[model samples]
Target: MGKKIILLLTVGVLAAYYVYTPLPDNIEEPWKLTWMIAVSKTVAYLNLFSEFLGANRFVNIAALSKRQEVPPTSDENVTVTDTTFNNIPVRVYVPKRKSVALRRGLFFIHGGGWSSGSFALYPHDFLSRKTAERLDAVVVSASYRKAPKHLFPTQFEDVYNSLKWFLRQDILENYGVDPKRVGVSGSSSGGNLAAAVTQQLTEDPSVKIKLKTQALIYPILQILDMNTPSYRENSHFPTLRKSEVAKGWYDYFTTDRSLENAILLGQLVPAESSHLFKFVNWSSLLPEKFKKGHIYKKPIHGSSDVAKRFPGILDVRAAPLLADDARLRGLPRTYVVTCQYDVLRDDGIMYVTRLQDAGVEVTHNHVDDGYHGAFFLLDLKISHRIINHYIDWLKENL
Candidate 1:
């Protein structure tokens, strides 16, 4: 019996090791990234067993969490409040150190393709807490309902509405935050929401808060041009690929999954937008350095039938890249981080050029060794270096 048990355990370990996706030497922390991807993929395959057993999966990928757990790590000088505003959950982090003046404020949105990540997750908690302690600012790590279950605009509404609640004078004062010194930030899909929310807040008349800055780390700025230079180059990048990221958006916005394969080839935009594409085509916004000599061909429109199903992907709120020049000009000072080996690399680069053209102050850090999901785990020096870069920028801007 003991020999059989040992044999079974060895086989399981060997299987997990064997299935790890190979990584190129150029990626950030290749070994660690491979291990993390292996674990996530293993969990994903294990989930398929539930379908065969005629029951829901034993684990909910969207809801996988351990809110009360804290791993052994550095930095313990922040106090956290797991609370809610406007009925949306938020994890607030305030530096424990005493201060005479109100500190800068930041709203952090966690990202797992907009369908995963939460305050219950440790990476987010650590990042938010570390931000508060390092920058000596108050950080509100907000949570929104996930997608495919909640549908489009609900997550946006939740984040924006709760933002309104947080910006109230009473709440800002109570948290030792300066209303005039507040900024927004997020990672990946959270980066998408942070950018969209920052753009929408520019037009909001009901909220008196003036955003001081925005930091988008590997944000998904547009849904249309899946054929951008980085997209062509990094579609096969580990963990977050071109199709997997678009699939999350598709699942979140609509019930139909047929658009999955078509959208991957940049074929989902409505045919009626030819006049609009001239302004947004790769030639206009993206810089030549980012183009890397890739010839610019206009996107092929999806069939009218394919276009009819997901008409809203082009909405500025859904794809901040679609926002008008006037609105983009009105945005606040911006900070953007792009990983060289990421599908979203061109998204950040294009936005930086667009924002700079509109006279908005911009700070961009292009990490040559970075890839998508690089700092998400916070298990390497490279991740901390990225965090420090943001901290230094926040010190100057916020």
Candidate 2:
């Protein structure tokens, strides 16, 4: 009888903890969503064990799981090499089959919210290899100096310097790459870097080897406002919770934790930038199909206080969404992909709108059933399809 009573107490405690433990805000869904929630919660709980090391160290440590050694190439179809260009480490993939003409080049940047990612990371390593064979292009998978240690523009500078080197006659000749057919592409924060690089190259008179196109897959383009439609709708979405978005930016851009609450409250930019809000404010920018009875709220009025603290947050390279119309004009053709269930969905949509407004040619792909970090789940059938579609668009444009 005593054993039975103990068993009942254990069951009650377990049920109560499962039911009441606060989860990062997420939509209550059935089976698949439940699984996603479970995975996200598990990561969060596991991360708590790293309290002794601090959250930043915890993030870096957790990221180690995503890193694993991958071969340079699968077979003779592609030849791969890991080398540093302008001191930035890169994974280069060259198709073994000789091309009738010089092959197109793809400069790829992997994404891990600007905090963690590498060629060793899955999907990145696999994606780079597959892109070389599928597109018959020389793929340069770039690895930049990571953040919270290296800091903001340092990551940008690494990619920019590598791009300049990649465009050199010696580099192109070695890879049999066509200078005019080069494309820059990246996923998530890497997408943000790709956009910034495109802007820098487009505006620089010294840059002669211009990109033919750029592909941004589920990029985070702005930190100015976090109350967009997607943010509200996907606040609790599994892979990248909306609540974590601004915090990620804070961790990446500044060590000042106090500014986090203000940024989260949408109080970074001054009230004068109100006119600029329309371009990125999702209720007006996102399609009616996405609205679906969703109500729009004006962002809380901002003081320039946080902006003063970290002024680089407002730079065009840091927040391409804030780039002037003139700056965005004459950009290379752009391909943007947004996942339906991703927190950054509106970010991609708003960017497309801004690109179109600036007279840039853009191809937009929306994955209705996709989730944030879905590409990481390459073992899943849907991920394969998403990747194929992305490659198909690249094939058509490049």
Specify the highest-TM-score model's number.
Answer: 1
lDDT of 1 by residue, 10-39 (tens): 999888677667666766666777777777
What ranges in model 2 sit over 4 Å off?
1-40, 53-74, 272-275
State in Å the error of residue 293, model 2. 3.7
TM-score, every prediction:
0.90, 0.89
The lDDT for every candidate, in the order shown, is 0.81, 0.81
The deviation in Å at residue 147 for candidate 1 is: 0.8
User: Candidate 2 on 1-398: residue-level lDDT in tens?
Assistant: 99999999999998656644333333232344455556657666767666555765635444654555565655778888889999889989888897899999999988877777787676787888888899999999998877777778888899999988998878898889998899999989999999999999987777778899999999999987887778878888767887678777887778878878876787777776676666567776777987777788776766777667787677777788888788889689999999888889989999998899889999998987777887767656667777898899889898
Q: Which stretches of candidate 1 lie over 4 Å from their true place?
A: 1-21, 52-59, 66-76, 278-280, 303-308
